[model samples]
Target: MKHSEEKEMIRDMARRVAEEQVRPLIASMEESDRFPEELVEIYGDLGLLQMWVPEEYGGPGGDLTSVCLAKEEIGKVSLAASTLCANNSIGLILPLLEFGSEAQKRRYLTESAKGRIVTSVAITEPESGSDVASLRTMARRDGDSYVINGQKSWITFAKQSAYMLVFARTAEGKGYEGISTFIVDCKTPGLKIGKAEHKMGRHGAPSYQVSFEDMRVDADCLLGPEGSGFKSCMRILDLNRPTVGASSLGLAQGAMDQAMRYASDRKQFGKPIAAFQAIQFKIADMAMKIGSARALLYDVAAELDSGDMSRLTLLSSMAKCYCTDVAMEVAIEAVQVHGSYGYSTEYPVERFMRDAKLNQILEGTNEIHRLIIARELFGRR
Candidate 1:
């Protein structure tokens, strides 16, 4: 099917699921810090969990644009749920689909599509953060298996995931060339999950510290080839970052929607707030920013689907950074237009604002993306 039709279908499905399954539980989920397993299952039944997997692998074979549109719709309702879905769909599944062996795909992707397993990507260490190549995690070869010993931090869904796509150093080297990727079951003997992190928002999706002490995995667990993990991870990020931007766009859209409704209904100075010039200007700015960001996100997703990977890393970074920043700005301004009511939990704008802040930090930090964009613009020659 054509990409546009696929996107529309996914969007409609996601909107219905979000409203019926996610919106009803947002309050309690956030308050209780619970993962929405039921919602995940619903999405799985709708083929969203495996949208990008090839049809031969028991998936819908949807393009990246469809994935982004679905994520945007889900994000409009619950950022936490949208984030968990996006991470699983892109950060975990995309790498495996792109680089895993046929046997590996058969083993994992099939189960993952059924929502029988949850997966996470482990790259950031307590000491590494944005300096991915400087990671200290080590996996040394021992006969047919490698023994892994390291600590990974800020891993989303780590505690609940059934597997992790781990990046570790296999050789003593100066840079990314030494890194390799492996698929490790969460039940591995030496893998341990630390306490869940307390965060500003998206508390429904918890982050955790994962420690690997002498964990053993067979050579078959290796993804792609040795010394290729960094490139694989980068490629996955390029394809997925547009969805992150789309999530931000979703939050911005929700904020604008709430603001518009509140402005039109709430009266002040004997008139509807929306009728005032000050409120009109804020609404106009929010509309323009959201529209522009949505365009950029969709454009990048389309380019990725066409296999025009060139310049996309930079464009994805740009979209992620710009759209997220705009999300935060628009959400904050939306609250301002709502007055004191926006500050209370009774309103969704405050939650939208909190959710918008998270997009600036995930996928890749906006600060790191700026460096990437600058390098691309100036030509790394």
Candidate 2:
């Protein structure tokens, strides 16, 4: 598929920023578990956060391909930072575009596009991970307000967000139809944050458990219609999954690049390791896998861009599962090539390995994705 000049320009710009700006500070950010607020502001100024939003709403009105390209570039440097950008771009901004009322869009998208406000989606809970329909959080209607009460776990950027797009149960029915989504200001009354989870990877992006006890939102805060939360959330995930795959592709590419560099420089048996057939095979495999993954991701992005929504669920899930799994494999091989240094914090592979693992688990686990894929193949619901 041919890409526009604008897409190529955005990709180049993002790659330069990732290599020059984000990559240098990744180690420090990982060590301290600090969110890169300064970097985010720079991305905002560059319109990274609002690339997909309509131009009227303070965005460049770019397509999904541009978003994926930017994400891939950033992911190559730091998956945590890429995820932060993705969260705002897809998790927060896209949903608003799809379902937000005109007033809500004017209020949120403008600030989010400008990077003045950070946003995140609250959906996963302690007991509800892939089984989103099983979530127990409730948002009860009361005189022109919904009193939300529940605990949301593993919420990304919960510590730094100004607002969160929350999902909760509003009806007493079974399955996805009972769920609803709301836009809640993070500092609203009766909202409390639990301790940040010490994760295996992506430490630079913190996750938290948020508690909402009688937290109230005006009726206008509702996203889309009642009982449509689960569908809207799934749609957003479908749109975002390719970006996740792109992120995985970036990490794998980084690992491949690092491994090749190490093999060239590191000497063994009086010769550089790159000369050895074993190291050569690893590099070949890494390159091949990353190429295939990138192709799949781009195909999905192209399909979305062309307004081909059929089979999106299957394609997105496949890309998410395949790319992430490949990233994990590439990270391991990269570390193997690095030998002892890979295990140490002195090298970035250890962190890359951690960040790669989360991609398989998030946006629905690989196991759940397989189910979706199988269902599609068999023509099952």
Best by TM-score: 2
Candidate 1 residues lying further than 4 Å off, grouped into runs, are 1-3
lDDT against the true structure, per candidate, is 0.85, 0.87
* Cα TM-score per model: 0.96, 0.97
RMSD of each: 1.8, 1.5
In model 1, what lDDT does residue 341 have?
94
> How does model 2 fare in lDDT?
0.87
Model 2 clash pairs?
Answer: none
Question: Pairs clashing in candidate 1?
Answer: none
Residues 202-256, candidate 2: write the lDDT tens digits. 8788889999999999999899999999999999998888888888888998889
lDDT tens string, model 1, 1-381?
135565777789989988888898898877978887776677777887667767777777877788788888988888887876645666457887789888988987777767555678899988998888999999999999999999999888888788899999998865899999999988999999998888888868888999999999999999999899889988888778888887788889989999999999999899999999999999999999998898888888777778887888788898899899999999999999989999999999998998888889877899999989999989956
CA lDDT for candidate 1? 0.85
